[model samples]
Target: MSLHIVGGLLIKRFGKTGIRSVNLLRFRLAQEFLLCFILTKNTFGKIINKTMSKKPSRFHVDESDLWCKNQCGFYGNTAWKGYCSVCYKSLTNRQQSSSHRVHQHASVEKAVSQRQATPELSYSKFADKRRQQSKTNPVKSLFKSTKKDKSEVDKTSSKGHHHLKSEFGAFLESLSRPIYEDISKRVQNFLSKFKLLPVNSTVETWSDAVQDFYQIITEHINVDPIYQTLEETAVENLQDQLEMYLMNRLYNVVFCPPNSNDEQEDLSLQKRIRSLHWVTIQQLEANVNDQDIGVRIALDKSIADIIELDTKTLPKDKLACIVESSRKIFDAFRLSNEKSEVDGGPQSVASADDFLPLFIFIILKANPPRLKSNINYITRFASPSRLNSGEGGYFFTNMCCVVDFIEKLNAESLNLSEEEFDSYMSGRTTAEGVNTVYVCDGLRLIHENNGMIRRLKERQEKYANSVLNLEHKLSEFREQFDEQINQLVLRAPLTLKPKRGKADIDLDHDIPHSLPSPILPQQISNSQI
Candidate 1:
């Protein structure tokens, strides 16, 4: 107050310069006061501090008890800008149910802002009148009906690219060229048909699944199962689920003797199977069961962890409880080859029949978010190149589709708790929350994807652009043709060049050119005489 009074007095006593100085002092004083108030150990002060710190703050409030969690599942509550700070008076020391409050999370505000910015769909009078005419008009009634053909199955099985069997089907019959909006809508509708695809997914929702898919691939092959039970259905079922999710067809693969391995003849067959997204992973003996100490230790540790964390109360000493394994086979994937290239071919543990199953188990139990981080890290290191050289010498590209499947599953089930899962299984809720079944299917899809990628790469060399010297080739051909023509023209010109010392040789005055050879001896003899 004293400072303000002095400042006022100075301003009143001085000219414009003094007035400017006083105003500057006043602004500084106000700012200093605000800073002091914020750091004053008051809840309201801190809230004000945070609000003032960020841009576009209108009002401030105080909260003593606000906590935020950053689980990525829920759509409505992610913090877009930064932290979520709550201001509470805490009138009563007793706790209150946090869920009851209407306080806005940062994401909520961001969403609201976004929603507000978007324009509403226009409802024009002209468009409305045209729509109304379709209902009332009698002559065009037959054409106006949106009803689809009833006998689709009876119709040719070789229909359009896709069928419009469902009302919400993507392939709507139309004469006009497809626009971007229509394409987007059609994609959404088609994705809707995949029963395994998350029902709640929007058109762009599949994009979010990309990262998760990669994560699944990198780690699934590394996960080992401890139980010597040669193999069990637990992991198999999950791989099957993965296959179903991706709709891959190559979910089962077998590499037999020379003649039996003839399936690679038609490359596109593998692709078609993979498009459906089910594939059985193939392994070669060399990759999985390397006799190196490092390999054994890694596999052993992974299996130990799998058993310890997943199976409850199982004692190691109980020989019958945990049956052990046989032989030199390591039923898991590893970087078996020294290089991506091979003289005969790159060897793998395809013979280890149990490798695929063990790999699947490791994948499902993985912390998905962490797996995503690792897979992405690998991709970053593996920069794009002309030859698809192994960046980290990893074979999980096709395997990554598992991540995509898990993502969809996580998205669908994030709302459920353990109790909810129980209720769901019990049919108290109509939706069954069993995610394990679907995970196995995802594994199958990963294998199929791997096959497809190989096939696609083979075909891409033809269709995909390459730097070629077409212009030079054409130019060379032109030059050769032109040279030949010029030579012919030059000979003709010589025939036309005025016969310098000799009489003009025309067809009528045919000179006896054949006698010149015989005349050599006779003419020489005569000249000598």
Candidate 2:
């Protein structure tokens, strides 16, 4: 308080100009410190006196001088080359040189003469010494002080390189943060809903949940502001990365491979899971289109994963699981049609045509057997038009093309009798000689579609012919009306009246007269008039 009063008095006496004076500021600061020290001097006087009276330990002198300080003219102990920090590099090199000479020559004099004459040998020995120096332990070997320095250089270089790499990786991740966060939020929402279902849920239950989740995902992508804000190339790159991440998440969770177990309940659960997988595939297919290229690519990868995983686990671990894979193909077909009835997906019925055949082709490729059952399945359900066009035909033809290849690579032969072959190709007969296979759903559907196509063509031709006949009738009616009009004009009688300044000519006048008259006979002949 006293120091502040004194500083304020000094500042007030000089006014604002005193604040700008460095000498005044310094004098007042010194005065404040002098006053503070004077007030606290007696309080700390005893402690200061005691601290000043104490002293450090005294140093002792050695009676005999050490070799390092006396001989090497240094201040410390002589552990290496009579000096504390000195190294015996030349001494170690001499030892290595002597060892090499001992191995290469019988006498020291000849060895020295050879080494002197051959400069390459001395240079090689020096290079070897340098290399050994670089490798020697820094703490244990006195001759290798350079090794410590080189090791530190290497460590710093590696650290800097690793830092640059890590910084670059962090930069890339920062650029993709928006896309990553968006996909991560969506995946979390999906997994949250997925967890709501019980572990033993039925295929139908899981299918409904998955369908809803797929709809949400597509809607999120379509309406995302980030997609709208980015350029086309940037959008595609982000989409590629986002889809890879999303597919990875999905493959691990919803579409993960079923665990193998011999329990009956587990087997039943496996069947339900397989069914759910097919439904999920159909759902994915429904959402995939030209505008959804990311989704389409992701779907393809997911399908490949499912196929590879399933193929590795089925039918006694044999790679030939396609021999009896017709049932599952049929199930996918039925599921698609059933879904179509409910308007379950985003795809139209035409878009859904390839779903069954694609998986069928995958199965056949994985395990190539006789093409009989597969051919029947293809010809049965899919119409010729649908099977021959688009992706459907690609897989269909590939299956057929591989048939010859499979035959050439055959390890086992296919055996079938004439009766059996006929039965397999055509419909099977019952004990009553009735062909029960006629009622097969697949065949019936194909027949119905073929009949519909034929009917459509017939109706088109009939419409064209009717249009032609109608045009012909219109022309005939026009001609008949013209003829009737001409007959009316010919049947009517003709007459001529005299003009104001011209003579009248009436052939119907029986009495000839030199003067022309306006009046004439009541009846006039048509030809004369």
**Among these predicted structures, which one has the highest TM-score?**
2
**Model 1: what TM-score?**
0.18
Q: Score residue 339 of candidate 1 by CA lDDT.
A: 28
TM-score for model 2? 0.22
lDDT of 1 by residue, 1-529 (tens): 6668868787878866788788888888888888886777586754566456433211111111111123222111111111121111121112333543434465688788978896545667668878876555221121121333212212322232233233212222321233224433534443333223432333222322322342343244235332223244533433333322221110011111122212342233223222322111111112333333344444444435433322221111111111221111243234333222233333332331233333433444332222332333223221111002221111232223334433333212333466754554454654322222223447536655766799999888755543245666778999999999999988887445655786565648655787565554434566687
Worst 10 residues of 2 by lDDT: 429-438
Candidate 1, after superposition: displacement of residue 257 in Å? 47
TM-score of each: 0.18, 0.22
Task: Report the lDDT tens digits of candidate 2 across residue range 1-529.
Answer: 5546766776788886776574567677888789988999975675565446433211112312222333443222221222212222234357778998887766767777877884566788999999976764332221122566435433433334455445434534666577656666675576455444454443334334543454455466568776566576664444444333333333322232232121343344333323222112222232113123233233334334334434331111221223223233434444544554465433223222343334433332233232232332332222222233333333333333333323332111113355743453343622221111122346535665776799999999999999999999999999999999899889995677866775578646566687688786698689879
Best by lDDT: 2
